[model samples]
Target: MTETTPLNDIIASRIARQGRITFADFMAACLYEPGLGYYTSPGRKVGAEGDFYTSITVHASYGRVVAREIAQMWRNMGSPAGFTLVECGAGNGRLACDIMDFLAEREPVMHQSLRLVLVEQEPSLESAQREMLAVHIDSLSWLSPDEFASGSFTFSGCLYSNELIDALPTHRVVMTSDGLKEVYVTCTNGEYAEEAGEPSTPELEAYLKRVAVELHPGQQAEVNLNAPKWLASAARALQRGFILTIDYGYTAHELYTPLRKLGTLLCYYRHQTEENPYLRLGLQDITSHVDFTTLMEYGEELGLQNAWFGEQYRFLMSAGIIEELEDLERSDVSDEEKLRLRLTLKKLIVPQGGMGDTFRVLIQSKRVTAPRLLCQRRIGG
Candidate 1:
């Protein structure tokens, strides 16, 4: 692929004039910059033809199962009449469709109480979302932080996202034999090159201290400054509700281990993983694994009580996902529909080659009583 991305030009020119740009700048440009960035552009990001597959794209049951869990959370919150279900980074509205469809069928009362909100940043994705959700646009509202903040957004329901956090910009740093240095991308000789810069800011140093705890010498890792910011913002937006985050990542200790020397930064294009994000700047998707520990800690600091955390498979199993299958089987459904249902159920919880272990689920609540959460450790004592 040619390295002629407009985003790269803008970023490279800035780096050329300013010496070095932080990984955060690089990431933001590569993913969110105007019309040329990967996420900001009109491209298939999640699905068979896309760079990766999210649970919602894998099967509709993913959203259905998640909706059931949300219903349970609503019930735990006394089944408030004006509950909201806000889905962040809603791509193509597939998840919303599945969740609302299941809720409409099974819990019509709670479904009627639902005010669905999709908070997406990119206009292209939002346009696509509107088209995908045209039939249900009346029931759903496209929202942003400002729009969500306009009202007394004290949610009595769940605020959820899937495969969302990993896409946030992160700072990549390495502890070399010489000392700590930030990684910077530069156009050198003829191609994009990576060089070490000075130690990151004091703030970054402190973040690294926490992230690099117990890390052996020369270990490399990524710091998601945006993750905590997002959590804090979410915490502020939600006056009273649960924050459900689902993503693929490890704890801080694991992410900073010596074995992870090259860090978790990666790119995906057409379902294939690539290490050279610069090569396919606008065409591919750039992502880093999230630090679950960071998310949990920051969320708690923002008054979001840690409710539960577990592997996606365990979460699904505990949320009675299999019961949905049994119900489908027992119902007088058609043979084809039953087969599809069985296949979807298998994809969700059947462990090997399925989403069971690959994804994870974390639920945190604010101003909510400690309720027994399925598939997770007990809520705050």
Candidate 2:
């Protein structure tokens, strides 16, 4: 209850009986287990009080910037009278709050016409989102994945998620002279250790084949089979809209560089990032940097076009964040509140030692071309 109690024990028991579990299994239990997983345990997982932090939690302005972008996107879509705006993995609803606030203040009509859906699998978090959006209860709706994935819902407008992809279950592999070997977990005297299992899943083998990149010998990397599936599902669920993904990662070319032997698997505990995911069990957060190249390419295969890609900082800047800051500076609010807002903005925009550099944004569209997006320095630009 205090830490990752029940889930950790469950995983440890599996390790005790079996030699070790696969990294994917370990992560799935740690993060998505019925009630004991880190995400479901109800501790601080998004703010400073939690084990890790996200940009939206850092500042309300982060969400405000996003809201502005969404507004622009709405206009680009011809301001559909009943456009759908879906936010999956809507953690803590902070971003939703910001966007809602922006709508109320800026585009009241669009706010009224919009249909907002917050899709979260966790009941506890769903309850939290309900509380956060109580004022807009009429416009907002909540659904579990089971409800939405039942193949009954159709959405159009925008599909957005922040820091969602990295959490998907991924198969871990280490490249050796002998070729790629999966890193599965095993039990050793009641403790868990990793051992090589098999080559790769049939789908994973084909994914690697298409990406056509070779990992350095002894390099350990994560391959997320769930990512493409998730995106594909989003594409299917969405009829005429854009799928916007924001995460940390590189293209395949940069990810599998020869100079870099270690892959992008990592863990975070009490805000300290580390390489060993086997420690602390369900108490800490485990994640892999997303491969945007995989997302762009795979999503495109599903009829989504790569609209744009850039760092979070550039995206926020392009959304007129500076003007928002200046407005806040001139507002009737107290200096203390203004200072706090500025600090939050700084945390989101600082190029080094900040979330801006740590995060990247990939925008893909369906049935539309790229609009005049701002503040992005593309890879080739």
Candidate 3:
């Protein structure tokens, strides 16, 4: 039997009062329901002790390479004196720390002008972020996600996120003989179950049309209406700068292929992949693959240009991973440690059962005239 959690009871009560709720609503509650949610009530969420590993956990080099890209972005924008670096979903501030450390040491001018605004949904994480980013205390600031997207916050520097969009609540749908039907959650016998019905919003159908996707009969897919909405807000806040998004996903054509009958919705717990999101309630992390096509298309509509889009490996390799590896070799670490670190860095760029191809990087810009980014260079050129 699946164990019941405090969030389970809260979600059950919500369903009892609201009849049936959309899967998106259930997922949002599971992930962001104040103190009981998985992320909001986190206890080490992104390392060996946590449910999963991200590129950041692999090595500091990942963020350093990203930092290199951001430095180049600063130069591309004429090195604005008051550049603000905003990181949405800044978890524990590890990446921000690494980036700031690199800039402080190497790109001192840009670092001097850099102001990092962390936008996190969980308020309690601010302490952890502050502690992690203590060295750059003067450069650090915090903002709630709502405030960051409220149209009041504007910035003229790069905004970046790693593995963020996939966590936003996604509406699941299945192609039935009748038509596209939304997956809804209902409580029966005090347990959660799924039922398909008319979509709660017409935007679901319009989303598929925007991507030109047609699901085969009985094929299940997740429509992330929230991703585009988030992009819209990000675009609105960027007066003249770039948005760098790194996450695991595909273009709309690859994501909604008929072969992938079951959508990419997944649950992660203790490093194990769970097919059943209903089992753990808020204890496990539920996420779906981001759709880059929608981000690109919707970004254009929001007056942002798709500057670059490619796999993580290509971005890292072209950006600065090789130089980072060379620096590791020049360092005074033991030979065995160097080899170990080399292998660890390989995990970030190797394809075939690795994070390299699975994760993608999207760079979008606004009001930048022919902005040339490091990731746009030819690999090995």
By TM-score, the best candidate is 3
Q: Whose lDDT is higher: candidate 1's or candidate 3's?
A: 3
What tens digits encode model 2's per-residue C-alpha lDDT throughout 258-358? 76676788888888997777677677888888888888888878898887887788888777678689899889999998988788787787787477777
Error of 3 at 336 (Å): 1.4
Native-to-model Cα distance after best TM-score fit, residue 92 in candidate 1, in Å: 1.2
- Regions of model 2 farther than 4 Å from truth: 1-4, 15-20, 334-340, 374-381
Q: Taking the tens digit of each residue's C-alpha lDDT, what string does model 3 give over 180-258?
A: 9999999976778899999999999999999999999999999999999999999999999899999999999999999
Position 3, candidate 1: lDDT: 67
Global lDDT of each candidate: 0.78, 0.79, 0.94
Per-residue lDDT tens digits for candidate 1, residues 76-192, read 888889788888888788998888888888998998767888987675677777777676677787777556545545455789998888988888877777777788877753366
Better of 2 and 3 by TM-score: 3
At residue 122, what lDDT does model 1 achieve? 78
Per-prediction TM-score to the true structure, in the order listed: 0.91, 0.92, 0.99
- What value does the lDDT take at residue 45 in candidate 2? 85
Give the residue spans of candidate 3 off by over 4 A. Answer: none
Instruction: Name the candidate, 1 or 2, with the larger TM-score value.
Output: 2
lDDT of prediction 2: 0.79
Q: lDDT rank, highest first?
A: 3, 2, 1
Compare the candidates by lDDT and give the number of the best one: 3
Stretches of candidate 1 exceeding 4 Å from the true structure: 145-154, 211-214, 331-341, 350-354, 376-381
